[model samples]
Target: MARVVWHVPVTTSGTGSTTALRLFRLRDGRRCAVGFSSPEALVALLGPDQAHTELGEPALRALTAPLGIDALVVDPRLVAPSVTVPAATQPAAPLAPAPICPAPAVRLQRR
Candidate 1:
């Protein structure tokens, strides 16, 4: 069996090919893809602490940003000293209420 692994960069497109998330099986002489949106759920499906890493910053951000509003997983182009936050996702646990991201994730959905 042949397998390829990927970590979503922005979760929009991926390296070379394999742009979207999917499962594929060789049919006839062709390998075709099937789309699946639940990487986190898939991760769960794969079992605990399987040891994986995400690829492509743009693809990853696109996949995660929308769904993971309150909880963001950033894959920056470069290391950041700090970043800005929106208001919705912020925890009121602080004395000074920090802002959370208001813009909803554009792509991808969370399970």
Candidate 2:
């Protein structure tokens, strides 16, 4: 039987010697390690700019277990909502004026 290898995304530091595994957060705020079956699959979700390395399931699990991440998401399809910037031609809404309040009177006590 052929061993299955997963493509794991990583971020490289200077000289590429120091690399850190890329991790994602679940909707419930739990951290998870993400992997894909192939390079194409990884690129499809993370874009072409993402760097990845191949690792066996055991290796992937071992790497993340020490970090307290037990969830391993394979070929995850969930994506965050994209941010939209308002056009420059559109005018912003006016701000409301602050409310004016009368100053409180305070009596001073002589010691």
Instruction: Note the Cα lDDT for every prediction shown.
Output: 0.40, 0.92
Single out the weakest 10-residue window by summed lDDT for candidate 1: 69-78
Candidate 1 lDDT over residue span 1-111, tens digit each:
534334322223335343444322333434332222335643544444433444443454465455432222222122335786766975567587678869876887799
User: Using Cα atoms with residue i matched to residue i, what is each candidate's TM-score against the true structure?
Assistant: 0.19, 0.72
**Candidate 1 local Cα displacement, residue 25, angstroms:** 3.2
Write down the lDDT that model 2 would get.
Answer: 0.92
lDDT of 2 at 12: 97
